[model samples]
Each structure stands twice: as C-alpha cells, then as structure tokens.
Target: MTGALKVGIGGWTYEPWRDNFYPAKWPHKRELEYASRHVTAIEINGTYYSTFKPASWAGWRETVPDDFVFAVKASRYCTNRKVLAEAGESVARFVGQGLVELGPKLGPILWQFMATKRFEPDDMRAFLALLPAGEAGVKLRHAVQVRHDSFACGEFVEMARAAGVAVVYADSADYPAIADVTGPFVYARLELAEEANPHGYTDAALDRWAEAARLWAAGGRPEGLPYVEAAPPPNQPRDTFMFFINGAKLRAPAGAQALLARLNAPA
Candidate 1:
C-alpha cells in the first residue's frame, strides 16, 4: 500500500504571509481557511507555547478542508523537564486539553526536545513510554524532534522504533539530522528556507524533496540523508508528513505550496 504524502507550513498566521500568500484584503480570521485549501497539512506551533479551549480547537477543525490535517506540537512543559518519567502529569494535561476536538483532522503530536538536552537512553525510554497510544477515542501518533548530536545513534533509533514513535528528520544546519524511520509514519521538518528565493527553496531543491516524499510514502528511504541505522526500515508503505519551518519564515507558505504542486503533478 502506498500511503499519502502531505506537505505544509508550520503555522498559518504571519504578517509576511498576509502580503504574499493571502489574498488582498482577506480577513485575518479567514487565514486558516485560505491556508488549509492551499496545503494538505499544517504543524500547530502555537500549541507548543499555550493551551486553547475546546471551542478553539473545534473552530480550527471546522475552518479547514475535510481532508486537511493538523500536526500538533506538544507543550514545552511536557518535554523540558530533567526527568522524563516524571512528566506524566504535564503529558496528561497536554493530551487531555481539547485535542480530541479536532477528531480525525488531528495528525501526529510533535514532542520536541531542547538543543541542550543530551540523549539519555533510560530517560528517553521512560519518556516514550509516557506517551499514550490513544486519547479519548482518537488514536494518537507521535514524533520526537531531538536536536542534540547525542541522539544521533542507532540505539536512539532502535528505542524509538520499539516505542512506535517517529524520530523527526529535521533538515537544519544547527541540528543533527536523523532520517531513521522509527514509526508507522514519516515526519520531516525542512528548515533551510532562504529569502533570496521566493519559494523558500530553488526548483531543484523542491524537486528533490518532492521525490523524497514519494519515496518515503512508498516505504523507501531516499539517499543522501544522514541516518544512524545501517539497515533500512520495513518495506511497508507509511503516511509521510513534511513541513517547511523556520529560517526564512516568510517563504514557508510558498515553499509548501510549491512542494505540493510537485507532488500533485503527474509522474
């Protein structure tokens, strides 16, 4: 089976995007409506910093297209602590906070770690165990974004795979890029956007990413990406989620749209 590929930007609201992506005179409230139509998915970065009411989540769900998905960023309180096992309360609060209101529109929850946090195998295992398999009636998917180079080891990949959690393949100059497929799905964050290019990336770069997305959807790892494990993941199709984030934030939407166009084009 060939799983679906979704390409999108981090958050929808940005003053710069209003000028380039949004229509002239478009109401600020309807920005999500416009963005959801243009991209297949979006990573909710705001959720990482603050909690919202159930009505807010529901409203967000209602504004997007039927097939659009929102990948939520887990709150910093849940992952920034010294003891991963002791974060049960924070994790519980985050999971119980109106995420189910999005229902089927919700995708993976990104558990991002700070750059200073080193990899502790035992602590990491305990943390992964803290993530519940399901919340309310909706099945939950999780992806972890580890920034420290200490996480760039086969042991980390193996542990994530055992827990059925995807290790985020962050394409950043500062962070260690771990492209191992450790879960049933693939999650990637592209962060090398440049203001010099209107689309955030050159046409060649976009094409390369488009192909990479296709390969990942087909359960194949693309070449040239850094990986800790020498062995490939199981040759089984899996859903692929990609987001254009950070760096040249102004060009993110255009980057997402351009990549989506490439994915939608004929083979």
Candidate 2:
C-alpha cells in the first residue's frame, strides 16, 4: 500500500495571499482556516523564530481540519550555533514548549541549519542523540535541512538513517539537494516557484512534482534527482510531506494548491 502524500506552503499568513488566494475582505484571523481547507498540510515558519503560548498551539489545532497536519520549524537556538552538540538544552526547550498541545495535528519538526554550517560527523551525531523520540506522549518525527554542500555525503546520510531522522530533500538552486530517503518518512522543500506564473510553477513542473510525490509515497525513488548514496533502500511505504517554500514567496499558495489538486485527482 502507498503512504499518504501532503502538499502545502510554508505558512498561511502572507499579505499577497490575502489579495490573491483568500476571499475579498476575509477575516485576517481566519486565514489559517481558509488555507488549511485548501492545502493538505502547512510548514509553520513562525515557530522557528519565535515561541508561542500553549493556547496558541491549541487554537491552531482547532482551526485546521482533522486530516490536515502542520510541520513545525524548530527554533533557531536549536539549530544555528557554532557547536551543534551543545544544543541539548535548546533542543529540549523547543521540543517541550507546548508542541504536544497540537497533538495529532503535529507532523515533523524541521531542524534547519545555517548556510555556513558544515558537516561534522561526531557533532551531528551528538545533536541527533539529543532529539527525543517523543514529546509528551506524541511521537515526534524530525527532519534536518542542511544548507551547505558539505552535507551532501554518504556519511551524513548514514548518520541520519541510523538515527531515523530524514535528511530534507531541498529543491533549490542555492542549496545542496539531497534526495536520500534516510528515515521512515520523506520531507521535501521545493523552492523554484516563479512570480510570473499564476501558479508559481509551470503545469509540466507541477505534474513532475506530483508524480515524484506519488513515487515517494509508494516507497520508490523518482528519477532526475541528486542522491548522496547510489544504493536504494528496502521498499516500504512512507508518509511524504512536500512544501512550496522560498522562491517567489507570493505564489507559494497557488503552487501548493495546484500540486494538491493533482495528488487528490483520480489515479
């Protein structure tokens, strides 16, 4: 059996979306409600820079649909540092800061590193060790987005796989793209949207991404992507989360919705 595939944008709150995506004069507070209905999932970017109250997390959970999920970006303190191995306290604080309030709505927690951060095997392993398997009864899935080219190595993939932590597949011109499926689930960040196109990406591009998402959900790797390791893993269905992020930020929602439409279409 194939796993579930979710397509979404980085976040719901965007001024451009208010004019193009949301209804005219829609309540600002209900943007999440509207966006959640359109997309299958969302990657919460705010949590990476700031902390929210437990009530805020609970309120967000109430706003989204039952099947909708949110992938939260872990705090900068937990990722941006000179020494990753020393981030235990920060990691614990970020993980325990009421993420459990989201309950089942919580998906993966993205740990994004700075562009300058290079791969250090021992340090990375230590940081991975600090990531708890669960938080307050909710099983947590972690995905790391490493920006530097140094991360594009088999050793890094091996370490992540050993820890059951997915190495984020970043489709960006500036970042190193690693398509290695190192964990039980797949996390992808697509950042090639264009402002000129109404849907950010071309129809052909969207079709290709949709097909790739399907292949990933079915435990099969897609062609034309870079991989650190040449060998394939055992075939096992895995949940897939793909988000339209970064480039042409204003068109992210459209791209996400269009991709979701393809995924939900008759197969």
Tens-digit lDDT track of model 2 for 148-241 = 9999999999999999999999989999999999999999999988999988899999999999999999999999999889998778999999
How high is each candidate's TM-score? 0.99, 0.99
Cα lDDT, all candidates:
0.95, 0.93
TM-score of predicted model 1? 0.99
What's the lDDT for candidate 2? 0.93
RMSD of 2: 0.7
Query: How many clashing residue pairs are found in candidate 2?
Result: 0
Pairs clashing in candidate 1?
none
Off by over 4 Å in 1: none
Q: Which 10 consecutive residues of model 2 have the lowest summed lDDT?
A: 11-20
- Local lDDT at 248 for model 2: 95
